[model samples]
Target: MRAFIGMDFDKGLKDELNGIQKVLKINSKKGNWVPSSNFHITLKFLGDISEEQVDAIDRIIKSAVVNTSPLSITLDKLGYFNIRSNQYGVIWIGIKGEMMKLNAIYGIIEKEMKVIGFPKEKRKLTPHITLGRRVILDLPFSQLREQVDHELGKEFLLDNLTLMKSEEIMRKRVYTPIKSYKFNKILEKNHR
Candidate 1:
């Protein structure tokens, strides 16, 4: 199955993201907007994997999150990766807060996944939640960017990391959780 590891957001965050997407949809000429139910922050994309590989990845997740506390993250800004000479792009929302902890979790998972034969990720992690793909704005990107407010939003905790399976069902992409690994150990108060 096609799979990945990611963090799911609470309903509140999903609602907030939906609101943002609604605004984006109004300003976009055309794009494949991500469904609110599909909103998540991908920690790693594992692509296609067999049942045996899923089992191995389960172990990796268990070890990676050991002694890790819940992560607190907030929305930082709206951003995009230009895909076709700036004519089209993938629109995304930037993330911030508890980034060090987020990176450490990713590092542990990446290192151990490599030991299990997965290739090392070529790009450094830039945490963001994808909002849309093949996106073309109604106005110039520079104008849209300057018009939007960029700042902190409500903070939320990612208490667990989920292993997600992706499938195209009835022409819509759906992500289902295969398993979730909770952060079993909390940091001492002094560590904060």
Candidate 2:
């Protein structure tokens, strides 16, 4: 299954991002917007793995996240990926606050997965919500960036992490939550 772990956005935060999408849509090219429902900040992208490995991956994830407390993440910046000639890949929302803790969790997941024979990811973990893809126009990237920066200064609480399956739906990629794990401090306190 093609899977990964990520933090989902709350409804209020989704609405805030949708608002930014609306403004960018006015003068933006048709392919420049992503469905707001698909927005999420990925921690790890565990690509295709055998069915036999599913149980081990679950146990590893549970061990890594069981003790950490829920954190608040604010989506405050706008940026692009591989912006050389034109922004072809993504326009995204950036993250702030409690990022160190998030990075630590990602590191633990990467480390544990390596012990089980899964190859380490080649790219560094960059925490951002992908807003759109296949952008084909040279619309004022700077203006769009500035607008997103001004309007999307909202914060949301992240208390849970989910293991998600990414699948093709009518030729478009969609995510489905397979399992969700919550943080419990009492469990950690006892462990220490």
Candidate 3:
């Protein structure tokens, strides 16, 4: 199965992101806007693993996350990926507050998975919630960045991480949740 690990936003955050998407759509083409339901911050992408590995994958995730506390992420800034030209593969918001802790958790997952035989990703980790794809040319970069920044200044709490499955059906990819792990203990402690 094609799978990845990520943090899922609550419905309220999802709605807020959807609103940002609506505004971004004014200057963006149809293909450039990602469906709101697919919005997530990926921690690890484990591509096409065998069915025999499912149990091991679950164990790895549980072990990695069990001690990690829940993190609160604020979405700020609208951004895109491009080396040259305006070929935006992903439009996303930047993460803040507890980002380092979150990164540490992701590192643990990556380390544990590698120890168990999963291949490591070639790309460096950048935590951001993907807002859209397939961007058009001549984008109003300054305005979009401003809008993202304004929205991100508003804070949101994150309490859960999910293991998701990616499947292809009728030429489009669909994401389904396999399991969800809560960081209740992390949130219960005082933020000193």
TM-score of each: 0.90, 0.87, 0.87
Computed on alpha carbons, the lDDT of every model, listed in order, comes to 0.84, 0.76, 0.76
TM-score, candidate 1, is 0.90
What is the C-alpha local distance difference test score of candidate 3? 0.76
Worst 10 residues of 1 by lDDT: 183-192
- Ranked by TM-score, top first: 1, 3, 2
1-192, model 1: which lDDT tens digit per residue? 999999887688888888888777888888998999999999899999999898889988888877887988888788888769545678888989999999999999899999998898999999999889998788887666655554337677777788999999999999999988677644333234
Q: Which regions of candidate 1 fall more than 4 Å away from where they truly are?
A: 146-152, 185-192
**lDDT string, candidate 2, 1-192, tens digits:** 898878776677788888877766664665556677777788878888677887887888788777788777787687778755564577777888888888888888889889998778888878888777766544688777776677865677776577889998998788888877666665336545
TM-score computed on alpha carbons, candidate 2: 0.87
What are the runs in model 2 whose C-alpha is more than 4 Å off?
A: 185-192
Counted clashes in each candidate structure:
0, 0, 2
TM-score of 3: 0.87
Report per-prediction Cα RMSD to one decimal. 3.8, 4.2, 3.6
Residue pairs with backbone atoms closer than 3 Å in model 1 (clashes): none
